[model samples]
Target: MLGQAKAFSSFSTNDIQQTKAFYEKLGLNVKVEDMMGEMLIMQLNGGGTVLIYPKPNHEPASFTVLNFPVQDVEKAVDELTAKGIKFEQYKDLNTDEKGISHQDDFAVAWFKDPAGNILSVVKDK
Candidate 1:
């Protein structure tokens, strides 16, 4: 049925231009379109797309809206941090100095966009 259909995710931001610039700085190929409404299409390096639209009263998601799987969580954290991205710290999760938390066999780190939408980088298992 719909199992083979390509699916994409969409989220809202208070400012489209600021959100677009934040993502572009991280090296993601972003395409801006203005159809019925303005949208920023994020082309992920691993073959996926996310649509970001502008909203007048947008509130960032409390939970992670996107997760990027990386080969090395440490290296990924380091690079992103050096690019001025601040990682979130969860005290109870026992995060390291890099703000990465490890549990079981995987590691994960979280950060937020200019709109305060949470996003994460996780160890590819």
Candidate 2:
């Protein structure tokens, strides 16, 4: 029944301004809203929206909350690294020097937002 609903994801951040700046640095289209206090609306590339709200006692999520599909994981990693983004290294994933894990048919790299929420760039299928 809800299949036609235009649902969106939401997450919490401690500082809205800092989070907004960080996402802007990544080239995302972000806008600030004053609804129920300060919030962020991020417009994704292909088409989708994510709502970011401020929480005084926010704790970062342990699992990845967002994933961006890129044509080349290596290129995406390089560009983000040049922008001062640091990729995360996982011991069990067999990640390379750039923190990208090469599996049988795809590659993926992970990084955290300014608020410590996990995000990733995965090789597009």
Candidate 3:
């Protein structure tokens, strides 16, 4: 066997409802399941999951970050922008006029979830 490779993946957030809604607004169906103490879990379609636990009390092994594969870069960005998604840009990093970066086989766009989780979308190769 080639082994299991990588196993499960997840991230943490501050608020369940707001985080869920934020992903939903980005065209992802973020599902909220179970509530334990001040913590909750949310799943983002096809992109793994995020855990939403109360702030100032929960500590995670590491912060969650994600990179999504998309079919088209510009169209995806347009759709997200139409829904009020704002992208971050760094002048030090090469960004197009539309704030996306096209490098080699990958074209990328970026945004964040409600609780400050950084995320990116790249053209599926």
Leading candidate by lDDT: 2
Per-residue lDDT of model 1, residues 1-125, tens digit only? 88998888889899989999999888899989996688899998767999999989999999999999999999999999999999999999899999999998899999999999999999998
What are the per-residue Cα lDDT tens digits for candidate 2 across 4-32?
A: 99889999999999999999999999999
What C-alpha lDDT, on a 0 to 100 scale, does residue 119 get in candidate 2? 98
Candidate 1's displacement at residue 80, Å, is: 0.7
TM-score of each: 0.94, 0.97, 0.75
Clashes of each: 0, 0, 0
**Cα miss at 72, model 2 (Å)?**
0.4
Candidate 1: lDDT of 10? 87
lDDT of each: 0.93, 0.96, 0.69
**What lDDT is obtained when candidate 3 is compared to the true structure?**
0.69
Decide which is better by lDDT, 1 or 2. Answer: 2
| Candidates 2 and 3, the one with greater lDDT | 2
Please report the candidate that would top TM-score against the real structure. 2
| Cα shift from native, residue 98, model 3 (Å) | 1.9
Tell me the tens digit of each residue's lDDT in model 3 across 1-125: 53855344566766767776777676665555656655445455654555556565534333227787889988988888888888767576687776688777778877777777778878888
Candidate order, lDDT descending: 2, 1, 3
What's model 2's overall lDDT?
Answer: 0.96
